[model samples]
Target: MASSTYKRYHVHGYDPRQHLEHYASDKPDMAFEEDVLKFPMENLAKTFSLGHIRGDVLIDFSASCMIHHLYAACEFFNHIIVLKVSERCIMELKKWLDMRTGAFNWGHTLKLHREIQGIGDELPDKEEKMRSAIPHVMICDLEKENMTDPIVLPPADCIISVWLLDNVCKDQDDYIRYLRKCSRLLKPGGHLILLGGLGMTYYTVGKDRFHVFTYDEAFARKALAGEGFVIDDCKVKKRTAMCDLVDYKASIFIVAHKEK
Candidate 1:
């Protein structure tokens, strides 16, 4: 979706699938954040319990193709729902899931779609599965759809949106609004895991190059606090570029949880 609003403001600099050693930029030959350190999935599981999932409902916003977190959540939760505002992201996820149809359970993998409310209709059947076959993954985005739309969801037990809000938002105000939207999707005492380049300048995905809004950790913490979320625990780390091109400043990753 090309927008006149975004003239040369491309968000991604390289394709997520490509090797950073191949880039021509002057950035130190690090590695894509996704490929660098295996996201602390085990730690995430320890921090939040799917078994204690408040309302049998877990929602994710702007969950791009990164399904690792989702896969981890399904280990305990029953009904996992994902919403995606970007059709391209949705299609890409579907394609990835399709590849695993043989060993992976598509029906159990998730109910990925354009909206989060769709799960309400399938909650019954979803809860029936017992042996870790939970709806652990759902992706929702605010770009293609409005957060107020009935299709959007209320608060959920676990809410996560990584590398989403900063890239799509128009400015700081827009970013805050998007975070509030994320809060709205969770129940009062749910956990919201937010991760991305805190001021992630420019980077490559695989072959596509894009620019990040340079979101600030301090500002993000304040925004989350303003949204009634308690900074339960937050860890900030510098993200080094993997591409062989120009290495920009380091990026940050933050995690916040909604207060009861």
Candidate 2:
């Protein structure tokens, strides 16, 4: 586990609504609009568009309660099992999944994704589709010997992690160690789509600032290669929306498949 002195998000303390308000808001100038929002969604759309990422089960290991990134992948996989580290994030995701009152409005995110897909008219229907694609959202810890301990998850065809490693890994070594854990969940030759920040050291939600593991593009490629994943595609977008809320200068999206 990460040894940072700051309030780590790996625990049960993450405030999902606060994080949503800070990063997932559709406000015109939200600081993380590019890094935390569009990068993953856009890249996901492109990756799935290539017609190579289809499978029976797609496991999502992401940060926060945000659901934007999964909109594009719903059609490619039969079922999506979201693994969350914190109960708070799981509860927040449930609130949205169950369509309860005051669930964070993911409509804007869906709209953004559809716009990227050129299927701008798909709103409420597509929203429901994404919800149906995801049938399970359970708690799991990457630090655990069996990330999905009690429930033995079938080896996934694909795994997508968005910014979760930034919060869970304390350093470069922790990054590789946790990555091996993630790989173990995959079927051999399965895909791994990772989205992370470049040179990002911290992100603030509400009044608390959480630590982020700082790494560059080279380190990312090296780590994935070292862990037996062959890099298929890697894309980097320089931080366009600048703010003090986060320290990342750029964001990265990589599509890799585990070697059989």
Candidate 3:
């Protein structure tokens, strides 16, 4: 999309309502499921299929409510890192993890094989080993320079950021820069997955306003390519259909892998 046209289409100074609270309490009705389902299962099975995740680390940035599902989906990974900037998110995941520790949250069915380690402090070897047996969750603010600051994370095999790019980038260039940083976090031949909130016009939380850009598949591909990510494969999924029945656009789901 042309920059001029893109700006014109987006409602200036739009703020999204804080839906995270609603999501934290209960899954608010949005098109996120539709978007996730839109991913071509065949391609996903090939790319993200458990067998492909050989890296020792899988970093999930701004993991929000996905910790539960991701834990179930990625069984092959030895270590799964869950990153989130929200305390509520951390609290919820911690609660879930805590329950699993004692007698297994929902019986022996909840397999606690992966560890969920928080960022910042150095964890003890024994603690790390135990946590690695369950999904690890950490509280981190990626937008802040001190913690995430782009230089803190280890070289990862796969870095996934969902519904977070639009919030960080002020414009297309900023978005591209964010993508470059994401690429840097991954090792050569690693992968990047971008998910959530694609076609939103504006979002508001409390008094905050979030400006959004409706990024299409081609636009996402171009942005990733500019960041040196060759499209190994891509599947577009709709995130939300908020407008009245007449006019609505699905959020775009993009999965782009970094190349050598």
Best by lDDT: 2
- Write down the worst ten-residue block by lDDT for model 2: 1-10
Q: 56-159, model 1: which lDDT tens digit per residue?
A: 66665642445545544554455667665545555555554444442223332233210122333444433234223433333343543455454655457787
Clash pairs, candidate 2, are none
Question: What residue runs in model 3 are displaced by over 4 Å at the alpha carbon?
Answer: 1-32, 36-46, 100-136, 141-151, 203-210, 238-248
Candidate that beats the other on lDDT, 1 or 2, i.e. the better one = 2
Write model 2 residue lDDT over 1-260, tens digit each, in one string: 23255677886366899889888898776777767777888889989999988999999999888889988899889999999888988999999899999899877777788788997684668878888999899988666799888789999999999999988888989999989998999999999999989988888887777888999999999999999999999999999876887778888999999999
* Whole-model Cα lDDT of every candidate shown, in order: 0.52, 0.87, 0.51
By TM-score, the best candidate is 2
Give all candidate RMSDs, comma-separated: 9.3, 2.2, 9.1
TM-score of 2: 0.95
Alpha carbon lDDT at 184, candidate 2: 92
Give the winner by TM-score: 1 or 3.
Answer: 1
